[model samples]
Each structure stands twice: as structure tokens, then as C-alpha cells.
Target: MRNYSGVGNTLTLTAPYDVASGGGALIGATFGVSKLALKAGQRGPFEVTGAYDLPKDNAAVAEGVRAYWDNANKVVTATANGNTPVGVFTAARSAGAATANVRLNGSF
Candidate 1:
């Protein structure tokens, strides 16, 4: 499109806190996964426009269902109350499964 910004899928921003590659990074009010290891005060790119396989809570997550972020456990869950939704679960996750593929679509 003529108005397309031509920006790639990832965005570069200063890390507000230490973040490991593939780990969640919450910048200002935006949440995304760090594409590279970044220390506090460093600048790096993060993948914010794609799905990511992230850790999930101990509850089973049905395929195509929405999932929320459990800040306390640093994992995603199907629960809606008191937790911020992160994305839709792309696949079913049995209880106690280590992780779930989530199509990230959340904000701070």
C-alpha cells in the first residue's frame, strides 16, 4: 500500500529492564518478546507483531481460546479475572504443560 510505513515486524526500543532473548519485555505500556538479550538502558528490537510460544499456567488451555497473563507466575492462563489477556491460544494445552503458542495481542 502507498501509505505503508515499511517497518518490519519487530520494533526497536530501549529496554526498561533486563530482558533475555525470547523473554517477555514490557516497554512503557507495550508488551512484546525481546529478540535479543538487552540490559536495562540498552536498545534492542523486540518481536511484537507475531505469535510466540510462552509459558502457561497450570490450567488446560483449549485451542483457539483467549489466554491471559499471570503476572505472579509469569505465565499465560485461560482465566480472565485479575489477569491481563495476552493472546489467543493457537493449540490446546493440557494442564501442567510447560508452554502454549500464543498469538500476542495485548497491551499494558
Candidate 2:
């Protein structure tokens, strides 16, 4: 058997600042979600994703996360991040697996 499912996207927001003369640079970068997955036993409950941002200057890029809720809950059952850290979500190091899954509606 073979099957897979996932969702993710790259998001970016910028605001430009000025200097003295006719030269300035762009700033501001928010955490951009890189990926989300729902795979089989291939990995774990979920591989918490990270983000990679493009910077312009001293634009305090992805310093901290912007979540209304505690970010840890979403990753409580993660097995491990992945081969590569995507971005700001890159803060996500690596974790272990959650309780096994039993398709028959019983304990595994």
C-alpha cells in the first residue's frame, strides 16, 4: 500500500525604511509556514515544520514565533523534524514519536 497527504506554503511581508540620501533598504519578515504532513508510519504523528525567510537588512528576521496559542501542543506527538530545517519554524529541533496508531479502533 502507498498513500500520502500534506499542506504548506511560503508567506512573506515587507516594509521599507529610509536612510539619509536616495538609498534605503527593505525590512520586516514574519514566520512563514513551510510544510505540514499526515503520513503513515513513515515518520511520526507529525513532522513539525519550519520556515526560511529572505532578509533585506537589519530587519530582525524571524526572531520569535507569532502564535495566539502555545506552539508546543502542535508538536507534542512529533517524531522528528526532517532532514533539513525549512525556516523560522527552523526553531523546531527534533522530537520522538507519539503513541502508536491502531486502525481497527483499538489499542496498538
Estimate every model's Cα lDDT from 0 to 1. Answer: 0.81, 0.21
Clashing pairs in 2: 50-89, 51-87, 51-88, 51-89, 52-87, 79-96
What is the C-alpha local distance difference test score of candidate 1?
Answer: 0.81
The residue pairs in collision within model 1 are none
TM-score of 2: 0.15
What's the TM-score of each model vs. the native?
0.78, 0.15
- Per-residue lDDT of candidate 1, residues 13-80 (tens digit): 88877888997766765667889999989999887767999888888989999877766666788998
State the lDDT of candidate 2 residue by residue for 1-108, as single tens digits.
Answer: 255333422222221221122111112222222233322222112112322222121112222322111123321111233211122221222223221111110110
Best-performing candidate as measured by lDDT: 1
Q: What lDDT does model 2 reach?
A: 0.21
Q: Lowest lDDT 10-mer window, candidate 1?
A: 23-32
